[model samples]
Target: MNLGCIVGLKEWIVPQDKAFFDLFEQMADTVNEGAVFLNVIINNYVDVQNQCHKMKQIEHQGDLIAHQVYEQLNRTFITPLEPEEISRLATALDDILDYIDGTTQQMYGYGVTETDDFMKELARLILLSTQEVQTAVRLIRKLDDPRAVEQHCIEINRLENLADVVLGNAIKSLFATNDAITIIKLKDIYENLEVATDKCEDVANVLSDIAIRHS
Candidate 1:
């Protein structure tokens, strides 16, 4: 390419690092709100449909942020992080919100009449995992301390493992009973909650990857 073309290309690809970080933080904030809403649903166990409705709003907000990230990536060739890394991080973050919303929907749609102790415990783990996720997301912007981000990731993995144990015990206890329909419904709800933690770990993995590469 000619010098003029090369210069134009360079200008076209200027980094908007702050914009991406802001968008990610907005997304993380929205998801955290969803997690809180979920806890409300679990703890209150009333008007679940309406509660799920409110959580849907947060999920929609997260979708808008994810779309903005994709649009930003399309328009900007130069980013503070690699394009792939940006996409992965955004996708992973979005997935957590999606699963959170999924659990809310399942809890109501599957005709779950009450929240069990297992479900409550799973919700707590999800909230804790998202808090870690939020910290990691913010820390990733600077990557000055890769260890800090990795520490958060480690905690996230530990939470996910705890979720696994919760799921296993939940299923074991569920099968021991004879109420087939209740067992089916609660099992689905429990599994969905556990999967939400799995999504959190996915976010941690992406954050850890970004920190390793960028820091």
Candidate 2:
């Protein structure tokens, strides 16, 4: 079925729009799995690329529904929560897919043939951040618990910070390797991976804002 139909059915079937949030959580998990697989084996690049692309499509559908829900909530003057909260959540979820798509495109464009320890670590961090995102979504779906959301946001931010340090050291080491061509390609790939982590932090920031406002 089409996205609108699925979302409409979800709104009709589930009480309080819980199923909508659950679908977003599943999308995050799918993206996380794709990130982890990308890091594990270089030969699996095509598979991960396809998977990430599919996940992006799903995420886009979710974003559309979120926008619709937000608009409906605004017009109705009565919703489960504030309009800003829904908008923030929708935008943050969309950002996650954008980052994932960017990472996959970079891998293919760079012709990455092998994985390194630093890249592996970055992927791990991305997975951790996505997991935190899933947690935040789950909490928001249920109690709208500000404290729980804040805790997960903090964890995501911390993980993103660690990714920055790891990326910096990796760049330094790459420069010292004395291979100009390799350094150029590796640097681009590393930077894109780091960018993905940064996007995750952006999502966390939005979630933190939602928590503050709702608290």
The all-Cα superposition gives candidate 1 an RMSD in Å to the true structure of 2.9
Which ten contiguous residues of candidate 1 have the minimum total lDDT?
Answer: 7-16
Q: Distance from true position, residue 56, model 2, in Å? A: 6.4
Per-residue lDDT for 97-168 in model 2, tens only?
Answer: 666666666666667666788888887888788888877867766554799898998998899899999999
Return the lDDT, model 1, position 156.
97
lDDT of 1 at 11: 69
- lDDT of model 1 at position 104: 89
State the local distance difference test value for candidate 2: 0.70
Over the stretch 94-149, how does candidate 1's per-residue lDDT look in tens digits? Answer: 98899889988987898777888998899999999999988989997888899999
Which segments of candidate 2 are over 4 A away from where they belong? 1-20, 40-77
Clash totals for all candidate models = 0, 0
Where model 1 places Cα greater than 4 Å from the true spot, the runs are 1-11
